[model samples]
Target: MNEALWALGRGTGVVALLLLTVSVVLGIVTRSGRPLLGLPRFSVTLVHRNSSLLASVFLVIHIVSLFFDSYAQLRVVDFFVPFLGAAKPFWLGLGTLALDLMLAIIVTSLLRRWIGRRVFRVVHWFTYALWPVALAHSIGNGSDGTSVWFLALALASVVLVAVAVAWRVSANFIEFGNARKGETR
Candidate 1:
């Protein structure tokens, strides 16, 4: 039924957001070459990769369910194009833009070996843009966006990402300082 499809779309979207939050945190941890929660560095990397893939799966389901739900009235063009939706075009467009970034990131990641690390890394940076855009889309367009639970979830995700980014920045600064000390010595 339409209600079932709507529920499926919303549920999958929430799950995808959570998974993406995990993936982003793990990715930062992996880049620092440090183990997370006592896991080995390699394990962190593996979890990061797996979580990203899982989030992509959930994202696909979310999109598909919404596309089928009559309430959404989504056309095929709405998937590829941004800001063209009949309802809440700006918010929906953010989701479309995030999807576009995700596609680019996924393709580049899959071809990393062939494209080389530099190119892959450049494309991967789009992920930084993707997460917030996706989050914005969720809050701006979602039916439960104003609910307490959804706001809590969004806040938690933001805090987690902010902390991870802070840690990465501080780690980099320390490493740079140590390198300078070594050079001076």
Candidate 2:
């Protein structure tokens, strides 16, 4: 049973990471105000929102499973606090911090209409920080962290995000240049 729990925790953690990667990439696409994979802009936004929610579900399962797994020895306080774990404090703490940030982002997003776009956008920006912190936590603390397969998975996630960000920046820059040229004309 304990082995089952451990496996569950590990599997869910990987799934959550993949889902988060998808969410991040889709988010970048949404912000670009462009369709992705030939889907309409609205469809991309919907998929982004749904993927984020699914990732959160997987993250919750991952945390819960680890908390129950004897190997982890996780305490309830450790769930909310960072750096207090007995083993691999720094790595586990990064995960805790990521969780905290994710909660804030989720809350702000849910209340976006009431809180206004500016405030929501500011909180949502934490996603940028959350992704790397979560990735570091996975690599630093995961049992398979050093395995070739895990490293390859992590590398792919990073590459996808990097490409999306580059595209977004270049697109914006070109738009800005075009606007400047129009002004000069």
Candidate 3:
């Protein structure tokens, strides 16, 4: 039973990693135009949304399974109460903060139509902070964080997100610049 739980935890972690990878790839590839391999534009958006949901689900499983696994010592408080994790408090708190921010994004997303686009857009910016915070958490508390496999995956995820963010920011700046130029003329 203990072994089963540990296996489940490990499996969840792997699934979470895969989902994150897929989402990041989809995000990066779709930035320019449509994706290959029969992937629809909406499909990319769906993949990003569903992958995030799956990642959150797997995170819950991973945290729960830690309680059952004798190897990884984790407490429930370490999740809700930031800066209290025995293993790596600073890193763990970051993970908690990421989760909180993700939740906020999710809530605002669900209420997008009702909340109005302006409000939704503002809240959505929180996701930008959430991604790096999650990466930091993974690096800080992850048992295999320093391993070649995990390191490669983490680096790829971080780089893709950074690129996407830069692209989006530059696009906004260009639009703002054009708007200002038009106003001046």
Candidate 4:
């Protein structure tokens, strides 16, 4: 039973990270006019939304499995509060923070239409922080974090986020430059 829970925890955590990575990348890439995978422009948003939801589900499963796993020795409060767990509090706290941020993003997104676009966009930007915090948690507490398989997956996620973030930031800078030139002219 303990072994099963531990395995489930690790498996779900990795899967969640993968899904989150894809969602983050798509969120950035879809802002551009170019269609992805020859799909309709609208399809990108659909995929991003679905991927994020799936990630959230997997994250919940990971947390639950770890909480039950005797190996983890996680208390209920530790899951909610940051740094309260016996299983490496600092590392566990990162996961807690990530979860909190993700929940905030999810809530704001759901209320987006009702609240307003500006608020939603601001909250959504929190994802930039969420990905790294979650990654740190995995590396610090993960049993297989340093393994070849995990490293390969982590490398892929890092590359995806890095490329997407760079592209997104540069795109904004270029637009700003163009706008500034227009203003001067």
Q: Which candidate number has the best lDDT? A: 1
- Whole-model Cα lDDT of every candidate shown, in order: 0.92, 0.91, 0.71, 0.87
Each candidate structure's TM-score, on Cα atoms with residue i matched to residue i, is 0.94, 0.94, 0.75, 0.90
Candidate 4: tens digits of C-alpha lDDT, residues 1-185: 99999999999999998999999999887765457679876899899999999999999999999888888888888866888878689999999999999999999999998989999989998999999999988888889888898888898899988987777666354435566456652
- Candidate 2 — worst ten consecutive residues by lDDT sum? 171-180
Model 1, CA-based lDDT = 0.92
Summarize candidate 2's per-residue lDDT along 43-126 as a digit string, tens digits: 998989999999999999999999999999999988889999999999999999999999999999999999999999999999
lDDT of 3 by residue, 1-185 (tens): 77788778766766765675566556554553545367876887788778878887887787789777877666777667778777677887997787677678878989998999999878866765776777777777776768899889888776777766565445344435555456652
**Angstrom error at residue 66, model 4:** 1.3
Full-model lDDT, candidate 4:
0.87
The ten-residue window of minimal lDDT in model 3 covers: 168-177
The weakest ten consecutive residues by lDDT in model 4 span: 171-180
TM-score of decoy 4 = 0.90
Sorting all predicted structures by lDDT, with the top scorer first, yields: 1, 2, 4, 3
Error of 3 at 49 (Å): 1.8
lDDT of 1 at 136: 97
